[model samples]
Target: MRKKTNSAIRRWMYAMAYTAVSAVVLAGCGNGGNEPAAGDGKLTVTATTGMIADAAAEVGGEHAEVTGLMGSGVDPHLYKASQGDIKKLDNADIIFYNGLHLEGKMAEMFEKMEDKKPTVAVARDLPESALRTDPSGAHDPHIWFDVENWISATEVIRDTFIEKDPANEGDYRAQADAYIAELKKLDDYAAEQIASIPEASRVLVTAHDAFGYFGDAYGIKVMGLQGISTASEYGSKDVSALRDFLVQNQIKAVFVESSVPKKSIEAVIEGASKMGHEVAIGGELFSDALGKAGTSEGTYIGMVKHNVDTIVSALK
Candidate 1:
């Protein structure tokens, strides 16, 4: 049995965050309009997740001191800020986050900081037509799954850095152009690799629906036990339904996300087995977060390549 639903974890985090935010609001405690640069005069930036942090580093180049709040395999949806994280945010000259409610528990805190700091949501300004929405019409915050969307986000980060530190505008623009060109190549690579999978077997089932953008971009049909947000529940009915899907389509493998528990996917595998469909665990994917700081999958391009290669190997 699953120990706890992602929704349960998120709810608990939200309560704790609400209490913390309330106290902070009451005391009016936060960094008050300090644009203090880093030790070497670079802007100090704090991002909510590894992906956004990577963007800052790529666009800011040596002009920003970047820090990420969430580490490898950390789920952003349910993550709550610690005292240490609050300190980082307070000291940062600017903050970047995925937005679209991706950081469910910390949205309020980010909102509070918008006025005091150059807090930007990289994906929030994207055209709605480019975004996928949930059944309830909320924009899906997993924009990083699509390489092109990620390129757009990188540009957003670049623009924000330029706006914050106009003196480094030339460096930021140059870096942004280089990174964008690299992402274009990455997009082609992903498409080529995904095309290697047989059309009939191009169905990607994972622990959650974080890969919708990937599927849309690469022509794969994505299915997940939970909804767009891991905060959604997956009951026995969901499991049985997904099991039937696997059996019907003769799916050979399902994937597990780094940031989501494998228990839900394991249950799906077990359910498929009972119905006579032998499915394998394809590979671990970086969904809501990236890999370790020094690893290959630590960078956005590398992470996407690893995921594409893993999917192609399992499904081809």
Candidate 2:
């Protein structure tokens, strides 16, 4: 199942409202429960997305097994559990998901099934002051975009795992310590790289509002053509307004998200051109999904680093 991390084999889905990279074909049935590993009695930990699953597995260490119902590049904000995913949730002993309305499609489902399993919203435990607020009560859910914010959530996740599986408390703590240290390294590295870019060019423009944490932490301005989630449609007025921003600021680059469609951004660029401004497409940013499975960008740390490097290089 392990492979070199890079671009995935998933077909690039370009729908009217969103685009995404979904390639993971989960082998075992969500509830089909074949058998647990020889020693790792399947703890049946459920996560809302692959990124959360990756973190849980790293933090959970050998004490537990985790499952992510949503595959890579699938937007959590727009995710809805499939029939099989519902089965997985029904069978799970514990569930972990990014709160703050990140799981928009599954929010109600999670709420309705809350009593069935011990659910932990990783982002919910963070201090209200630390969160990225939006017009809606829910804050930005992509805490993982910023290493320090993610570290805070990691501590919460570790505690929750320990509470769920007290037998492996020590193991959980050890892994959490190691993972947290690595996260700190990532934070430092990101800061250093970003410093190379001139402060004026540090702005980041993407198709969706996915990098509020990144903006808050890195001293960069994050502007999105669409609102917080892709669920809301962008109108001509929004596109024209963004075009004016690009021309007024003379922004050099605008980014297209891996999961969000490029049409709206194209519209912005075109409008800016008519206004006599220049804008180009930056490299694809992994806003919602990591790279492949094994590569540097495939891991959470790698994902953030890739973003940092890409942004700094482009803006600088």
Candidate 3:
């Protein structure tokens, strides 16, 4: 699990981030923001998760240095901060994180630092009307999964990045324009492909709650055992509740997230079996993190496409 940390150090000789990472697998760290004597003049940008980091990279290109707080297959809800992470936050010029309770443990910290930095909530940029709501609160925070929502959110990111670093304003705008075009193509392709699935079979059931946005935008009915945050556990009572639904609704298949454990989902499966409802584990879906670096499901666009393709194929 910790094997990849050294590889990134070979790329960046500045800081060893593994010591601060609670999750064994981490992305990258470097001599970012400022130097000890003379600041590197590079703008220090911090994102709470890999998805946000990837988006910033797409928009900022090489104009900025971003730190992804979460690593491979790590859940953002239960993330804990380390001493080095605190130092990174202290040095940050701007911060981008998924709001709407996605960062359950870090909400207070982000809120406290809001006045100190230009902290933007990418998911919150989507129109409230376009958001999917539940008893929990505002709406789903996984808006990045849907291309249209992401297109809107990217505007927020691009604008915020420009506001912080105006010297390379033109470059950031150009990148945003190009990236937005790609995002539009992504949305169009998702609509065309997901539409092919029969409407009746478009029910998506997952281990935890993250797909509300995907289902709302793509015409699938979503169900999950836990709430939006992974901080909550799937207790015996919770498992019993979802298992009962699976049996009654005759859900075709269930899903397990790549970042979240398979056990919670496996219990759902086991419950179904005991109740005589034989539901298959549809396929491993990329929820929080992007897939392996070079796979078809690696990029944000590809990962979502792969997920939609898998869900449609399994159900329809």
Candidate 4:
């Protein structure tokens, strides 16, 4: 299966290469209509994920035209950029992405583009002391799970924009300040909401280990069927082990992530049920991506609030 998947990806890459070249040539011919022309007074910023795009849009305000490549329920770890995305990246005045290998398949491409454009990894410059390491000793890429950490990422975006477009530094700073205050409120709300779950039941189980930072911030115990990245697969033994843990601890609920398949969680549910436990799917959580655009869950603050509300309602 892995081999077949890889082969398919290779074919896709080959196909995209042809499309990418044509896109670049076409873009050059028309000055890249996707981006604002020079003297249009707006910076063209492209972000890798919806969360990053939200931050850019809020901070950049009227000074930037922001575009995100991956949208709701999109998994960055396995995502491969399409030719159109390459064109957008090529024309962007600034590009922001969550680093620390979050966009695993696209990391190499970003590295290559760094010298060609103002590409910044919002999470990469964070103090190592503040980062959590996975079992493989790599920093966990889901830093947005912690509202405070996400605020730091926004600051990084603000700084990057200031450096790239100095004329709009003041605007960026003002918007960032406002956004930071709102994020503080969001952080407080998440803490208050999660606090409602009884201490004995203050445990979160999800499709993958994307909530380590969240659990750390809110004092909840989190378990995941798979590893930090959805790229990791769980076998029958892994499911059985989790089932035993749930059965012994009387954990009543587990969650499905927006970007990950529910099969593993379903398997665990079945395993626990067969063992005479009645475990339920607490709710769906936006782990790796936000909800659709224009919806409340589409925004970062709204996404966090939705997640906490879902968790509290189910586990309380």
CA lDDT of 70 in candidate 2?
71
Q: Tens-digit lDDT track for model 1 on 1-316? A: 2557877898899889867755664345343443338478878889999989998998988888999999999988888788778777777888899899999968877887787767889996679899999899988899999988988899889888877788778999999999999999999999988998889989999999999999999999999899998888889999999999999988899999999999999998998888888999999998988999899899888899999999999999
Q: Give residue 52's error in model 2 in angstroms.
A: 0.9
In model 1, the clashing pairs are none
Scanning candidate 1 in windows of ten residues, the lowest lDDT window is: 26-35
The best-first sequence of candidates by lDDT reads: 4, 1, 3, 2
| Candidate 2 backbone collisions, by pair | 5-295, 19-259
Sort by TM-score, best first. 4, 1, 2, 3
> Model 4 — TM-score against the truth?
0.90
Candidate 2 segments exceeding 4 Å error: 1-40
* Candidate 4 C-alpha lDDT tens digits along 1-316: 9999999999999988866674463444332223344887788888999999999999999989999999999999899877788778777788899999999967777776676666789996679888999878988899999998999999999988887777767989999999999999999999998888899999999888999999999999999888888888789988988999999999998999899988889999999999899999889999899999989999999999999999999999
Q: Which stretches in model 1 have alpha-carbon errors above 4 Å?
A: 1-38
- Residue pair clashes in candidate 3: none
Candidate 4, superposed: residue stretches over 4 Å from native? 1-39
Per-residue lDDT of candidate 2, residues 1-316 (tens digit): 3343222333222331121111121222232222332444646788886678888999987766788877656777777766577666666767788877888856766665555446778887678788776786756778888888788788888888776667778988999999999989989888788878888888899998888888877788899988887888899999988989889888999888877878879999999988899899977788887777777766788788878877877899
Q: What C-alpha lDDT values do all the predictions have? A: 0.87, 0.76, 0.77, 0.88
| lDDT (tens digit, per residue) of candidate 3 on 6-45 | 8776756434553334222122222232231127666678
Worst 10 residues of 3 by lDDT: 22-31
